[model samples]
Target: MAVAQKLQRCAVSQTGKHSASVIFLHGSGDTGQGLRAWVRDVLKQDLAFAHIRVIYPTAPPRPYTPMRGALSHVWFDRYKISADCSEHLESIDSMCTQLGTVMQEEVRAGVPKNRMIVGGFSMGGAMALHLACRYHPEVAGVFALSSFLNKDSVVYQAVQDRKGQPLPELFQCHGMADELVFHQWGEETGVQLRHAGMDASFRSIPGLNHQLSRMELEELRSWILKKLPLESSAQGQ
Candidate 1:
């Protein structure tokens, strides 16, 4: 069996009025509850966040791809650290199974697939991107920050399993100064995603590193609200 932790969400419906859900799969080493804190401070402050629930899945230890000098948790192990070749096949398989379990748990809690959005930071973002690109029937959406795609040798097999499905809209952001995952990975990931027929909106924030900014959070909040069945009138003050 796999280890899993539930995201202690901030916005719980008192009478169960949760209209939508955003699942946050955090990067390795970060607590699963970090996403909830992020929402309370940043996303929740936005007008749009009032109508939805955000799910943050906490990953349990053991059996991630090799990362030298870093003992953090990871969705998969992409050791290439460069564009040469980092296969994501193994990571993809593991993540799909774990994520499916998490999604099922949410559905049981009254969250539906169409209304759920998944996202992560750094390595967690990589996992989020992978799920959206490969999972059939798509999902509500995906948001990836400071992450890249895992190159798999058997990618064709994965795609074949998908049967040429259209992917969901992806919102990705990266800091040009990220010391760990190079910023170029973000651009390349966007290019690859678009080539694979995904609607990817990529952004690069100069002088920022790793952490999400107030500005970026606003943009993400806006974009998410637009995608969900939120009230459009909430836009523009």
Candidate 2:
């Protein structure tokens, strides 16, 4: 299949000099504009994010199996979760290739691989996890919200073949009450990452659903701040 053009993106940047870039992908049926608003609201009150440039890329409209073949903005076609919780590997490689183009643009624009963070929600988060592990392994961190990994997928096999490379720091969160992506799957994703030698941390939000909660957002904020500090500080500088 031919590689798709870069997806339309919505962006936000701090006023001062930026030291890092964060690319966040939205879930199915959502646009980058929607994620931009959500991320802006989540980080607006915090000054620690003042030196980061945030990018939200819209996924292409395609047939989604979870929606019963309805066309929606999705990184890849998601089939039914198997009994072993492994996702179908079809289209994952192509999708990651497209996402890698976006990362390449960021690198060409002067941001180092180690100064970039990649993350997303739901299916978007699944893409982020795959990209970080297989394609952009040198990134600063990876965040997967209400998402899981397919250990049997091609990406996992590729990562397993690479030797002596450091894995990125990972912070994953899932709601105990999440009906869409079960909490157990998220826990398994964390275990897989750790077993692959990643510095992975998984957070479970009690009584929360698939949707974002204030407490979950706060926890994510803390994790991001801890992982990527303000550039104004000496340590960060």
- TM per prediction: 0.78, 0.87
Provide the overall lDDT of each model, using Cα atoms, as 2-decimal numbers. 0.67, 0.77
C-alpha displacement of 190 in model 2, angstroms? 1.0
lDDT of 2 at 146: 86
| Top of the candidates by lDDT | 2
Given candidate 1, what's the lDDT at residue 104? 81
lDDT accuracy of residue 47 in candidate 2: 23
Q: Write one digit per residue (lDDT tens) for candidate 1, span 1-237.
A: 657454233333322256677777777677566655765576555223565766666665545445554545556666555556857566567766777777787689776778778888877777776665566345778888887764443432444455566556789888888886578867787776666566778999999887777777777878887877654453332
TM-score of 2: 0.87
lDDT of 2 by residue, 58-87 (tens): 988888887898998888886765426456
- Cα lDDT of candidate 2 equals 0.77
Collision pairs in model 1? 22-55, 24-55, 28-73, 65-77, 87-151
Highest-TM-score candidate: 2
- Which residue ranges in model 2 land beyond 4 Å of their true spot? 1-3, 40-48, 82-86, 232-237
